[model samples]
Target: MSKTILYARVSTTDQTIDHQKDQAEAAGFVIDEVVADHGVSGISTELKEREEGKRLYDKLRHGDTLVVRWVDRLGRNYQDVTDTIRHFMRQGVVIKTVINGLTFDGSTKDPMQEAVRDALIAFMAASAQAQAEATKEAQRAGIEAARRDGSKYRGKKPSYDREALGVVVDMLGQDKGASEISKATGLTRQTVLRIRSDPAAADVTLSRWES
Candidate 1:
């Protein structure tokens, strides 16, 4: 049997995979597996290059169904997003989005329908990418203004506390999976990787951050 898989991504700690899952469940999806990549700049990182994304690609099969909250969840840019979708469609996968109940069927035979689908994909993907870039630019402007003021500027608060992050670090050091750590601590997989990249630094910064 084919599975219904959810893929979610967040650029900051303020975002939570649990919420996305809840939203999907509320919308009546019996999600079989969730693949998430956290703290990655969607505008910059292509989906295929992400660690969790790579895992997702490997896990998906011909008959599987892929679900996302939005087209942006698949990718930030138009070309990357469309190409990724095309690849999945070629493999006989069905892609669905939760927000508007959007479904992209690569199996459409009618020329008109195919053109419409392609055009829709292009529009949505472009919009997603534009939004990401705009948000990034706004954040950059805010940070620059803060720098000019010389104020203590922490962009967003950390999602995990010292204790929770400590557990994540411990689990990571034990070579636990990102999904495992994310589920245990409610931290995003990207945050897990960031911590794993430098546990000692994370510990020190988190310690100071708490104080």
Candidate 2:
């Protein structure tokens, strides 16, 4: 008997997979095998790079139906998502989503229906990618404006501050270790270590960033 498989991913580990499973079940998918990718950010990650995501690639065969919560769970950008979906469709894999009840299959005998499906996939994938880029740009602009004005931006103290951590970072540049910097600044060893590791990247954070 052919099986119906479900794949679910949450951007953060804090979000439980149960919710996604619930939605899939509510949508009437039996979910024979569930491949879950957790604590992985979809923005910077490709579907195939994820552990469970990779499993989906290996397990799925021609004529197998793959169900996901959404298309975004399948990829990072518009082109990647569309390409991945189309590749699977060509291989006789059916892509199904719970949220919108969207289904893509390769059994279409009508040229018009295939064209419509392709267009819809292309448009939706582009929209998803554009939305992700816009969100990142907005966050960056907000952080930069906050930094220039010295206004509190993300609710609590920033995780990284050039003004305060600069000295420690500079000391590290002079060959200071995390322990030495931690002792000098009265900061935790982990914080000092992180600063030492990514000083330049850390230096751009706002002072009011929340954990």
Candidate 3:
């Protein structure tokens, strides 16, 4: 029998995979298994490279189904997301998203059906990619504005382990963008921007926190 598997990822401590499962269950999907990756941002990492994502490849089989909250949950870029879906489709696996109830199957042979399916996949994948970029840009802008206003950072308090913070500083030295650093480190963009805006202050904050 084909299994319906759910894959969920939480980029930050503030998020939960349970929410993704809840959303899927509410949508009436009978999930046979759930694979979750914690403290990993889908926007920065490819699905196949993620820890739990690797498990997915081994578990999914022909005629099985993969369900997610959205295409962005699968990948952050157009090429990455579509390529993933196409691979599963070639395996005779169906991909479904709870948010849109999207169904992607490779069972169609008609010219028009094939064309429409490919077009929709391209459109959705592009939309997912664009949404990720827009969100990252907005986050960076908001952080920059907060820094300029000399106001406290907005949203949940930024927290990270010492090692992760060190990675942030190292990436900053390499002149990476705040959003990129945030995504790469799984740290909040606001925290990345704050550190980027004032390394001295960040040093003092780190010293105080360490003490």
Candidate 4:
């Protein structure tokens, strides 16, 4: 029988394996198994390079389902994400996301449906890469500003980290309410609202804290 497998890349201390599993369960996914890579950088490491991530190719079979918190967990960049998803779909594996509850499969023979699915995959992969790039840029900028201003001007540390900020941003993009995003991410409602009002500022704040 085909099983549902949850794949997670835990990049930060706050983003724990249990937290991801809980999020998936909360999202209503009945996971049969879980494969995760701790301290894995989704932006720097390809899924195939991860110790547990590599298991996905061997563990998954035809008709099995692959679940992730987001498409970003599959690859490092736009091309990698797109290629990975297409490869899995071609292998008759259905891919699903916990956040948006998106499903992609190769069962559809309709050309229009295929086209739409492919387009959406491309868009999501691109958006993931864009968000990664933006976060990196914000960190660089924040570090430079901190260096220029010195310790005396360093602002108060942010309550949330980069991972939390990303979650908030994703929810905000989906037009989710601050209270909802806060509850989902375990962040304060005020923090969610601050991120919604100005994501760049939120990013900078987190970056400054890191600096």
Candidate 5:
């Protein structure tokens, strides 16, 4: 019998793998192995590079099936995610996801079915990639909007320590660039520049350095 392999990854220690596993199990997959990589960002890291994730690639075979929570779980970008799934399909590996109960297999001989399946996969993968980018853009826009009118900002209360603000001011006083101040004080360049640009508000809250 072909065994179902579960691949789960969390970008940080704070993220739990149980949620993903539960989703897979609820989808009726009897997981034979659970491969997980912790604290690895899906945005830039390739699935093949992950320690546990790499084993899934090597161990999965023609009769085996791979399950993930979503397509985004498989890869970070549109091309990368689509390429990885297509490669597996060509190898006779069945891909399934909990989100949509979608399945992709290369065993079908029907050209029409193949074309339809491939097109759907591409569309869904592209949609997933676009959603990820949209989320990032939304986050950036929110930050920018917050910066324009600090009163409307609803972020956490500023808690920048006195020492860090002192370093930032000293860096500015010395004519050190934002990048240099970021490196020296462990504050982001954006934070350094924000402080330099608005000393009054920066001194009051130091909001830029809080996060």
Candidate 6:
């Protein structure tokens, strides 16, 4: 029997495995199992390195469906993400995303469809890596500014933390409404709006608090 499994990486307290599962279910995926890695940095750890992530390789069968909140959940970088997707597809596993309802099937025999699927995978993987890099850069810059300025850099603390900010940024990128992001992240709509209005400032706020 082919089953659908949802994989999630919960790196912080703000993000929950249940929330991910719920998101997948809401997106109409009849998930048979859920695999998640807690306290794992998606940017630092490759998917195969994660404890539960490794389980995915063993648990998923040829016809099983692999579901994720986004393509970024599969790996840490562009190369890693693309490689992982291709590897799974080669094994006859179908990959799907809850966010965009995107599907990648290796069973497709059409040459044009294969080309389009490969292109889309490449684009999404690159985008995931780009977003990760941008977040890292913003944090580095914020930390440097905080260190140089000391107490002066510490303004009123942001209601949301680094992880929350990242979630907000991601939802914003997905074109989610401020109210929806606020409800999802447990942040106020005003905070979501503020982050939406000035993400760099939000990043600096989070970094200042971290320092």
- Report clash pairs, candidate 5: none
lDDT of 3: 0.85
TM-score to native of every candidate shown: 0.71, 0.71, 0.72, 0.71, 0.69, 0.72
| lDDT, residue 26, candidate 1 | 89
Q: Compose the digit string of candidate 1's lDDT tens values, residues 78-134.
A: 889999999999888999998999889888899999999889889999999899888
User: What is the lDDT of every predicted structure here?
Assistant: 0.87, 0.79, 0.85, 0.87, 0.82, 0.90
Candidates in order: C-alpha RMSD to true structure: 8.9, 5.9, 10.1, 15.3, 6.7, 14.1
Q: Positional deviation of 24 in candidate 2, in angstroms?
A: 0.9
lDDT of 1: 0.87
Question: Which regions of candidate 1 are displaced past 4 Å?
Answer: 151-211
Estimate, for each residue in 10-97, the C-alpha lDDT of model 6 and write its tens digit.
Answer: 8778889999999999989998999999988877788888899999989988999999999988865988899889989999999999
Cα deviation in Å at residue 14, candidate 5? 7.9
How many steric clashes does model 4 contain?
0
Better of 2 and 6 by lDDT: 6
The count of backbone overlaps in candidate 5 is 0
* Candidate 3 clash figure, as a count: 0
Model 3, 1-211: lDDT tens digits are 8999999877766668888999999999999999988877767788899999999988899999999898888888888888899999998999999997989998788999889989999999999888889999998998888778643543443376678878988998988899899899987888888888887776666655554
Per the 3 Å backbone cut-off, how many clashing residue pairs does candidate 6 have? 0
Q: Cα lDDT of model 5 overall?
A: 0.82
TM-score of 1: 0.71
Query: TM-score: which is higher, 2 or 6?
Result: 6
Report residue 156 deviation for candidate 2 (angstroms).
7.2
